[model samples]
Target: MIELVRPHAALVEAWNEAHREWGPGLHEDGFGIGAEDDVDTIEGIQAWIARTQQESGELWWIVEDGEVLGGIALRSADDERVHRFGHIGYGIRPSARGRGVATWALGEVLRHARSSGINPVLAFCAETNAGSIATLEHHGAELEAVEQRGDTRVRRYAISY
Candidate 1:
């Protein structure tokens, strides 16, 4: 079974494996990993894990059995970044795709948002990201528009609790 769990030191190795699967870049969306956050070293990983606890948003790892599959994050709607990035972000490791992991994880986060009183949650994905687009649609997310953000065309969507 897949479960969402808090990031912990105990899962560092598993997290690293997932991280490597993503290759180079800080594009692990749900991890809330900033460019300044170092996750390559023991101390850096520890510090990054600690920082998650301090952020305004909540981050959860997607774990099945003893392996880390990916991560999901629910950001406060009040967050300024929400205007562009939306209320949620997520990613599943390449090895874990096509198994409904994203769909399940997204539902869990939407529930979290609903419980927190965030009535209408906004989300965005690359227009080319069919997987994410389908995941959002699975939750009944309404497409608001498709806008250009920097060099990428992004599809904006909203889900009401």
Candidate 2:
């Protein structure tokens, strides 16, 4: 069974390890892996955790049998960029891919959102990400629009509760 838990010190190592698997994208984005050069250290990870927790949203770790599998985040769409990006985002570790983990994790997040009175959640993914597109469609999300950014395109999906 998979469970969502708040950011904690005990899971810092697991989070860092998962981030390492992603490589060079979000891991360096201050919320991903180690926020600083010493992220491998306890202090660095702890700082990263603090910063994430202090952000304007909720970050949850997807864990099963005490091992971190991935992460999902939900935030209020207060930023103007949310018009392009979505209000919710999720990602699965490479090792956990192709096992319905992303689908399950997304379902859990959507369920929680609906229960919390967050109707019509917004989600976005790169147009080239077939897996993500399929997951969103599997969950009955409607394809609202697609925006072009530089050479890439992003699909916007609206999930209504």
Candidate 3:
């Protein structure tokens, strides 16, 4: 069974394994990993985990049977960054893709959003990401707009609870 849990040290090895599967990049969405964050060492991992407790947002790891599969985050709507990136961000490990994990994880996050009074949730994805687009649509998200952000065309979606 899939479960969303807070980042913890006990699962550091599993998390790193999943991270390695993604190779080197700062694009692991839902991890709340900034360019300044280094999750390679124990200290760095603990530091990143501690930072997740801050007010910016909440990050959860997608796990099943003690294995870290992915991560999903619900960003505070009040956050200024939400204006450009939207309220939700997520990414599944390449090995964990095509298993309805994103779809299920998104639903769970939306439930949390509803309880937090976020009302309508906004999500954005690359226009070329068919998997992400499908996941959002599966949750009844409607396209709000497609805007150009840097070199990528982003598709914005709004999901109402």
Candidate 4:
């Protein structure tokens, strides 16, 4: 089953365990973890998540089957530069790939955004991430632009109600 949940600092342990990957993509084509140079410890992820919730009212959900298989963040309230271009982000634990979990969770977030008065939501992913790109389009997100974050590339998609 899927859910939209708020993660606490305590869940940092789970986030750390769940995020154990070379990166956060379902496909093995060319997906790599973002911000490789940055700290990826549970403490760091917790701090980042805390700030995201405090500043943007974003929430986290565990996409799991009794385990934290993957997670998604509802970032409607995020209007910072990163969010201004792409207000939402999500990832599936490598073990849970190709199961339609991402599609369901993203759809739920979009519905959450609409009901919560967050118009014109943004969803960004790597340009080469066809699975993520397909998921966004499947849920009605339009490709607004493709951008490069230094050497890394990103595709920005938007859905407006």
lDDT per residue for candidate 1 within 3-60, as digits (tens), equals: 9999999999999999999998988888888999999999999999999998888999
Model 1, position 134: C-alpha lDDT score: 95
Task: Name the candidate that leads on lDDT.
Answer: 1
Tens-place lDDT per residue, model 3, 20-132, is: 99999898888888889988899999999998887577889999999999999999878887877778999999999999999999999998999888868999999999999
Candidate 3: count the clashes. 0
- lDDT (0 to 1) per candidate: 0.93, 0.76, 0.92, 0.65
The CA lDDT at 13 in model 1 is: 97
Better of 2 and 4 by TM-score: 2
For model 2, the stretches where C-alpha displacement exceeds 4 angstroms are 27-41, 77-81
lDDT of 4 by residue, 28-141 (tens): 221122353233666566565655556553556563544655666665454564463456677776777788878887887787788878778877889888879889999888
Q: Which pairs clash (backbone N, Cα, C closer than 3 Å) in model 3?
A: none
Q: Local error of candidate 4 at 8, Å? A: 3.4
Q: What's the TM-score of each model vs. the native? A: 0.97, 0.85, 0.97, 0.74
